[model samples]
Target: MAGGAAPPSTARGGYRLSALNDDLLQEIITCLPVKEAARTVVLAKRWRYLWPSAPLFLNDADLPQPARDVVVPRVLAEHRGRFRSINLAYFRLASLDRELPGWPRLLADKRTQRLQLTNRNYLPPNQIGTLPHIPADILRCGSLQNLVLGFLKFPVDLSHGVEIFLPNLRELTLAMVIISGEDLEHLITACTALKTLKLTSLTPKRVHLRSRSLRCALVGLSRVEDFAVVDAPLLERLVLYLPGTGARVKIGYAANLLVLGHLDTRVHQLQIRDMVIKSGLKPNTMASTSTLIPSVKILAVTVNFGVLSELNTLASFLRCFPNIVTLHIESVLHDPSVSASAIEPSGEHHAKFWQEVGPVECLRSHVLEKMAIHEFRGDQDEFEFLKFVAMNAQGLQSLHVVLQEGDTSSSDDKKVNEAREKLQDLRFQTGISGVLLVLPKEGILSTLQKATDLTYNDPFRF
Candidate 1:
């Protein structure tokens, strides 16, 4: 049979062969260290061609002035047209004027796809003006895709607005940079293909962000989103940090709602599917309140509910999110009595007053489907108050009661144990899932394991 078999085909004609070869080449190139790739040029005539095709990655250590002066010129001379990508990072050139001319020229090559320039220190103020003109030769290049600039300080006269057009750019990250808001707006408008934009620790005097192509945005607390400026029809994720005053204040409005209103008509098609707002509180400044309710599916807020006045205000704000299916309330005033003195009961009798005015069922029915109360201290009064609301509200499917350990008074201990027993009884009688009592740390896990059956299966460890 072996002798009779027809001669094997000599041609390598198959899709599998091509795919395997491509994958093997990618794996081999990825496995090789940069040093090994650079050394390929000295291996032999056959290896010389491979080094030019290798990805060009230049970091501070690889491009020390002495090494750079020798290797850079050689790389540009030989691999100028063959380079697949160029990453120039943490480079400290001896002279801005001397380096600026060649740097942009090197980046302008149609072969360049990734260009990153990060300076360790601020560039000389006088040299800042020369940066924006970014050699017209480089700007005209159509191959660039990702551009990241760090520690860039532009001159005050720089009017290149936020709309700096880069037709092919997809991702842009500007860090520790100073630009005027107008220039920022110009840059946003110019980059029609920009998809992801991150601005951090930037001091833009008057910032305006009006982008038609931006899909994801990350802005600092100091800057507010001017939705009126954004024209992107497919924008999805937005993160903003609103500046906070030290004073404790109630959240009256949803920040997402306010930002969404400012967005242009084209932005209506742009869905803000996710939003996050973070703020710090001052000792006594009035708190920022928001009421803007956008069509968001997921929302998360972290705030200190130390002021009793803010609780109802927050509840009112939450009612606006009609589509919200999940709600989380953290570090809420578990023991409203801690500041009970501050809350003036409306009626003469305190007990009767709470029974009459407390909108417990209103809160349970209006916004919350399932509620999780974190850092909960088992005060019987608070538990009884929650139980009363749970009994009335039909929507509450699950309830998590976390018990935080602190300096427990004798009365407090008795009240906690009684609440645990009462909650257990309620779970058995009403068919409501028993309250989940959790310990805050791992050290107490074993101690709590022996203490109660209600200990959470995986206790939250802080």
Candidate 2:
């Protein structure tokens, strides 16, 4: 009776329900609601024990008043074979705690791959009690791949002598929960196989990211002042947004890094924008061309600047990327009162012009060919920035200015045309036939969004 459900009914041309085999029929029961699966008992003797014994998904929060306390453990005691994930609300924890080493112990069993124990009984993301300490048994799970815990005062507080190890966790997401920095560090180091780790909306005392194989790491809106990427040799993509002011991040090493944004860079395809790390005080000139990424072929930056003094930072930034062939700058005007001025190849901080004879190898390199300016406002400062890029690239192929939606009024159109005339006029004399494009935002974003693989033709999308 325990091993087999009643045999499958043979096909009756009159009744189609009789056609499914015992195994197929049992699978259908697993997808049904508990009441519907239980009702299958009345349909035929074959389903008598099937409903209660089917792989269960029980949420103590779903059962009404009195049943919440008693029903889960009663059914789980009788449940045999495999189980799909479990959820327990905060209110039921007190009753369930009495049965702890009995019911909570099931969560540690090898078959449960995903486990979440939180307070859906309280409120949206947090509630009115001490956050639960993760069971020591659940922490030692060798087969658990994804674990999520919510609204705990602290995520985990391992008992003094307990040995907690999660050898196979791949994706771990913790929200609105506090954990001591040392304990959190131990939890991450123990996972060994973690690929994606996201820590959101919690202020830990210290954060030391020392992972060798992490691929995608996102630390959002962190306030931690002492943060360091001690070592992450295999880390490829990272987004670190420390929205809190006065936080300085130090990147020790990410040698194989690619596609880093906002968090700061390690190499090749680098983007620096308004989103890039800010020094809180005025930004000093970007570090030297040698200390910065020497292998970078494309450099993108977002700066909030307005005056001639600020425009100088653009040249200083460009000087650091000698191997750059593609450059992207998004104008973010931080001060409206400040004005603009003409660019000088001989300015104090400006590097040698692309055409100037200089000791530096980049001038002769001819590697800079493409430049894209996004959110072009046609302001005096923005115009001067675009004009400077076109004038400096001796081997320039195309310079694109994608205008913001408001930058296209009738008067704005004339200014845009005036800028275009400068490029065309210079092209005849210089003989560097780089195409100058002033595009509307929608056309380009739509093209890139529609294609994921670099199948689209937009140079910026590359």
Candidate 3:
């Protein structure tokens, strides 16, 4: 009797169909609004008991203090034993100046599979210790699969080494919580089945993590993925950010596992910084030259020119990612001539010394398919640099050059016309297609019109 509906009519009389199966009923319940799902009991005589089977979705924003008090008791009275998930967000209980006593008991229910509690507002002093009450109960629920707890001011203590005993837990997210290093280590060791773990605003400054089943980890700390702290065996995707000046951080991959197998299988995506590659190295000595992450097909690198003295180091590091088809550089200066004036003059021949360092050579035989230079400024050195690139980059299909306007001299205008003439000639010589020169927003039209006229050859053609 699926959906409590009657069977197809026979010629003789109406026949009652069997009740709906669990899977079909669950699907229908999921489609219904929380209020509608709860009210479905009044739809028909047979549906009176079916509303309890509907999955629970509690939005704290919609629940006023009176509404919560009214709904919580009614829900517990009707479907207390049937709830599978409870999502609580920004729930502030005003009725009870003290913590709600029944909240922990409800989470302890064996049927509860997922629990999410997030309080973004500042809590009163008395409510600071209320977080542990929920975790204390949830640890007993063997069916718990996902747990997320975020606190604004409540600091957590993991010094005693709290272990989530739920063996089926797969996802865990903790924010603004404090955990001791030893307790953090113990937690990772205990949660062998966890697949995703995210930690933010953690205390004690650092935590050591070693897990066999962890697949994804997002850490926001001053130092994350320190080789001495993390030793995850099956971790495939990691997003880490380190904040704070003058603090050194280092991360290492196992020598035997240079190519990340999980990434190759489409199960992992790695985001690593260029600074991480240069950390923990002597001035001239190179870091480990090889990585085991062969499965990585996409890489986004942010090269800090301030840290890298030579541009060749950036190129050499890119070469390591062999499978990289698309490379995105956040802020890269292809033409080194832009920073010429920034160098301080030292002696009588300082100008000559600076001139020699101006455009070394253009990227000739690079593996990239496209290159985008943001804030591009063109001069004689930059134009010559473009010509050098035109000679190389055989696979190059697209080129984007963005220029910033500042002070322009008459000599600069003459050099630009000459460069445009050379580019127009090269465009005809080489079959290379799709060349776009983007100028500054202020004087773009005039610049393009002038460049086009100088390079125009239609009038000379018969």
Candidate 4:
């Protein structure tokens, strides 16, 4: 061996990754799961000390159940760097009370940024009210940006004059959390910089929101009987993804609202400004602007066009958003098991209902640029609505018809071809040259990640 030659590298066959510099190695370790990241220490002598130098990311849900209790505390105590994110979603509230009294302090000390501390224990609807309250200290993380708390109770008492604030927090998600209206208001008002808020499966009877900085809000799978945007000047997107039936949703004073949708025509009672929308309500006349909401540029509605009353409800619903640039229609299939007397008989007059429903200002005024129909079963009623849009939406540049999955009668390709042909025929008659796209339903499900993303223009598109 020459005197100046470098010492034989430990880089062995198939272990070429070790040849990379320490910074790259640390980054690779940070991206791995906590378990796999920890195991990297045993890979080589050099790798043994690299884990603690990188930022920590711990998710208890990814660890084995038996090892979680031991591993979480041990890693939290041993880690010597800041925490990138922590998700303790697999632990019960009772376990946290007994085993981790200093957990919140540990997080703050480590400069933790994103935390998801969830109680995974199942609670029935009646028991939810009695669930354990969130630890006050957990809300004190000043460096926190994104927080997700689940299956806990929010403290209702603000009597002590103690304030709760997260100055840098941006995104917050409360999933299956029990919260009184007063505390809910306080919590939201405290996060002054907050941008995105999601309320999922909450039992709160009423949710009245008021935020100046909030942009995207989603209320889904909740039993909230009344939900309203009380005063949000900068709010843009209000999504009701799968709200329970009989919910009344009202939009008030949100002048910048750009995207809204999935308003179930059969179940939701919609009110904009001063007007309470109903099935029989007609489009705005030349003299009245009270019922119109012109700030909304994107609108989504769920309807069973098979039902005559719901079709009319949809017509009334669209009349409110007179300046909608994009329209998303979720076609709900009607049940055939109902008595024949309940079903509207299909006829020439029924097909002409869209034409007779007067004028939808958004379509007739050429503000609607893009239109998409989801869960399209190729039913006649669905085509009627598309035809109406095609003929009236003079500025519509793109039309997408997404077919429902599991249609056994024909292949997906065949369904797409048939839909394209029908759309072509409609275009031929209307002299519309807009691009038409027909897509299968596979891999197009909307995800929570997309729902919370403020940058994603249309969260409900997929």
Q: Name the top lDDT candidate.
A: 4
Candidate 1, position 224, lDDT: 31
What is the lDDT for 123 in model 4? 75
Clashes of each: 39, 7, 11, 0
Q: Rate the local accuracy (lDDT) of all candidates.
A: 0.46, 0.55, 0.47, 0.78
TM-score ranking, high to low: 4, 2, 3, 1
lDDT of 1 by residue, 52-78 (tens): 565555443455556654565455555
lDDT for each residue of candidate 2 in 1-462, tens digit (9 for 90 to 100): 457654435223324464667777778887765446657878877667666656666555556767766776665666674566565654456567675445656755526666676655544543434555555676776667777765664534543455766777887776656676777677776778888776765557477777766765666545565555567777654555434533445555666544333422211112231123323213334444334545445455655435333344444445545666666666655433434443122243222222231222332356766766666654554544444455545556666666665667776777767766655654421355434455556673353233222232222342
lDDT of 3 at 415: 49
Scored by lDDT, model 2 comes in at: 0.55
* Residue 435 C-alpha lDDT in model 4: 40
lDDT of model number 1: 0.46
Candidate 2 worst ten-residue window by lDDT: 265-274
Runs off by more than 4 Å, candidate 4: 1-26, 39-50, 124-126, 158-162, 282-287, 334-348, 411-421, 427-430, 433-438, 442-445
lDDT of 3 by residue, 1-462 (tens): 778665566323532222556556656765565566777667666666666766665554555655765665456445733556666665553422234555555656636778777655535646654443334555556677887877732224543634467678888777765455666667666776887777765654555667778765655554333322256666654444333221223334322221121111001112232334433122234323343234433344433333223222343344345443343333334235436654322334322322333221112334445544334444333343345446555555565544434434465776445544555655411346434344444453342233223243111110
Q: Alpha carbon lDDT of residue 93, candidate 4?
A: 56
lDDT comparing candidate 4 with the true structure: 0.78
Against the hidden reference, what TM-scores do the models get?
Answer: 0.58, 0.62, 0.59, 0.86
